[model samples]
Target: MSEFDVVGIGLNATDTLIIVPHFPSYAGKGPFTHEILSPGGQVASAMVTCAKLGLRTKYIGTVGDDERGRIQIESLQGSGINLDHVQQRKGCQNQSAYIIIDQSTGERTVFWQRPDCLRLDPSEIDESMIKSSRLLHIDGHDTPAMEKAARIAREHGIPVTVDVDTIYKGFERVLPYVDYLIASSEFPIQWTHQSDPLKALELIQEEYGIHCAAMTLGAHGTLARVAGKFHYSPAFVVNCVDTTGAGDVFHGGFCYGVLAGWEIQQVLDFSNAMAALNCTAIGARGGIADKEKALALMARADRRVMDEIQRRL
Candidate 1:
């Protein structure tokens, strides 16, 4: 039996959020109102959400031996995620992002950098890490390492969920091993060269033979293909803050839904609710709603935007 509910293998970062009154025009100057430091990353924040939702979570990745790395490690440790395999690379700068948030619209622009000095090689992944978890979560950053982790999970009959945004150089190699692929809305269209999102999803799922393929639409909610049908769930209305990490939290909520055996519609709604709630605050993992809050949004939230999605189906 697997010892953990989910094990995440991917990126983690410390974000420095600078709040400005409004997004300045190109080559224009603006006054910044606030500055805050937060711990977040694509896979790490998702794992934090999973742990908050009562899952036994594990994080496997690398961090630099720096203050930023220490902050991220401390946050993960406090979240109760197992970090036995988290490597602290000496003389390396940990992954970091400088996010500029416009207080006026609650939108953000990000600049991030990760040094190759902290890359995780495929050979570093061991059978024990894969076998110890019932489900595996990954991102496309370290392509080779993520591929190896997915391969190990597949061999152990464990489900693998991926959260991808950008098109990686060799991402095609990772698709065959992914069971649930929840990606950015643009990924499918770009990957399959299909103008229609529904067709893009179908083509990708058919080609890869994945169990389900889906994409997260920022304010529009999520769209998915399962059991030869398309499913759509609209984003819940909420007070906007910052959109960073919304997708990552959505993936974490979806992982919880899958573990709970939720149906497709409910899963999408739940994930959407979680993502919407996260936008009510700054930083990626901030404002992670509890089960009650998420359920409340799912049950009583408006679905006007979702109508378009339903029509597509």
Candidate 2:
């Protein structure tokens, strides 16, 4: 048996969430309602979700020696995930984001920074680490590191899943090894330069021969192309308190479903439900519901689908 159910190699961040009554117009001022410090990151939070779902998970990444880094480390330490491979760089600050949340809509605008000092080197990834997991989860940053990890997973016949929001310079090398490509809605268009998401997904899956290519459509839900057919899963309705880590949580849920051997439609619906439930709390991880809660939401929650996307389907 694999030592771990899931192994994540990618980013981790600390965020300062600033909540306001409403997002002010450009250059306008308003009274802030709350300020919160939260621990979150792409692969980091996803691993946390997997752990919460009863998976034996491991996280491999670099962290800074700063206060924010300490907070991030502490958060992960408490999440029941293995951190034996985490690196701590001297004098480097952890990646951080200042998010402005509009209380009126539970929407957020984020300004984030990751210094060069925190970049993970390809050499830092040990072959044995990737070989010991049933599944591998990664993000887009540090292209060389992720590419190396993906290649190692591929060589071992382990399934690889990626959570990418932005385009990376050499991401082409990584996609060929990816079994699942779950990206932000903008990434497909940005990478393929196809204005239509459906066309963009097709172009990506066809070129890379990925097993499944999917995009998360923030409030509208998720869309994917698998085995040359398109599947759309509408977003679950919930009282959203903050949209901070919904996408990360979605990826976590997705990984779980894939490992569970569920159908594609079930995977998307469970992931959407997980993402919607995460939005009901203040921080990225505040509302990470248990498997039972997610199932309950999946069974009864109302769904919101985009008419434009529906028409295309």
Candidate 3:
């Protein structure tokens, strides 16, 4: 048996969230309502979600010795995730984001920076750590490090899952080892340049032979290709407070469903519910609902369906 249910190797960030009455237009100014500092990163927050769902989760990455890094470490420690391999770099600033949130729509605009000093080196990836988990979750940052981890996971027969939003150089090297890929909506078009999302997913899957290739369509829910068939799950309707970290939580839910042995449709539906619940609060992790709450929302909430997306299927 594996020592952990999921092991995440990737980014972790501390964000300063500034809430404004509305998004400022060109040359426009506005009064801000609130300011907050929160801990969130792709794989970090996803590992938090997995821990919240009662899974044994571990996180491997680098952090700075700065205050923001301390906050991130505290957040992960409080979440009950293992951090045995988290490296701390002296004199390096932690990855951070300044998120300008529009109160009217819960939409956000972000400016983030991650110093190269915090980059995770491929040598930092422990093969034994990769072998300890039943599943490996990674993000696109530090492509070479992720590629090494993914390759290790593949060699050990541990399933590899990825949450990628940006197109990184050398990302193709990591794809072949990925078993499940759930990317940001734009990544498909950006990677394959197919223009059409459906075709892009098909192309990626065909090339990499990934077991499942999928994309998260924000409010439109998720679209996935499994075994040559496409499955679409509509986003759940909720009074959204903040959209931060919804994708990470969705990926966590998807990992849970896959490990739980649910059908593809059920996995997408459950993931959508988890994401919707996360939107009902502030910050990346503020709205992460427990499994019971997610299931309740799944049972009762109305979904926002996109007819155009359905038509493509």
Candidate 4:
């Protein structure tokens, strides 16, 4: 038996969320209603969600030795995640984002920075650390390191899931090792240069030999192509206070679904519910729900499928 259910190797960041009444016109000025410091990142936040779902989880990443870094460490530690592999770099600033959330629509615009000094080196990865887990979750950052980790998981016969929001240099090397890929809405189009998401998914899975190629449609839900079939899960309507961590939580929920052996449709529905619930609070993890809560939302909430989803259908 594996010591950990999900081992995440990737990035973590300390986010500064600025809540605004509405998104301002590009050149227009607006008053922000609130500011908050929150702990979040692609793989790190997903690991936290996995931990919350009672999975034995571990995180491997790099953070700067700064206040933001401290916050991230404390958050991960509190989530019952094993951070024994996390490295704190000396004299480097932690990854950060200034996210402007439009309260009116629960959408956000992000401005972020990640310094090179905190980049995880491929040499720092220990094969044993990844082999100890039953499943591997990773992000596209620190490309070479993740490529190594994914390959290690492949050799061990553990399934690898990747959450990538954008294109990364040398990402192609990592994709073939990925069994499941859940990316941002823009990623498929950007990576494949195909206008249609369905075609993009088909091309990715075909070329990479991945089992599943999926993308998250913010507010609309998720779309995926698995085993020559497409599944669409619509989002649940909620009183959203912040959209900052919705995608991170969604990936976490998806990891849970994968480990639990859920069907593709159920996986998307559960993940969408998890994401919608998280948006009901102030921070990235503010509304992370347990299985019971997520199920309840799935059973009772009204689903909102925007025109983007309708057009696809």
Clashing pairs in 2: none
The number of the candidate with the highest lDDT is: 2
Tell me the tens digit of each residue's lDDT in model 1 across 1-313. Answer: 6799999999999999999999999999989989999999999999999999999999999999999999999999999999999999999999999999998888889999999999999999998998988899999988999999999999999999999997998899999999999989899999999988889999999999999999988888888999998888878988889998888899899999999999988999999999889999988999998888999988887763855567757
What digit string (tens of lDDT, one per residue) describes model 2 on residues 162-186? 9999989899999999999999999
**lDDT (Cα, tens digit) per residue for candidate 3, span 49-69:** 999999999999999899999
Off by over 4 Å in 1: 304-308
Candidate 4 lDDT score relative to the true structure: 0.92
lDDT of 2 at 103: 94
| Candidate 2 local distance difference test against the native | 0.95
User: TM-score per candidate, in order?
Assistant: 0.98, 0.99, 0.99, 0.97
TM-score (C-alpha) between model 3 and the true structure = 0.99
Query: Candidate 4 has which clashing residue pairs, if any?
Result: none
Clashes of 3: 0
Predicted candidate 4 versus true structure: per-residue lDDT over 170-193, tens digit per residue = 999999899999999899999999
Clashing pairs in 3: none
Better of 3 and 4 by TM-score: 3
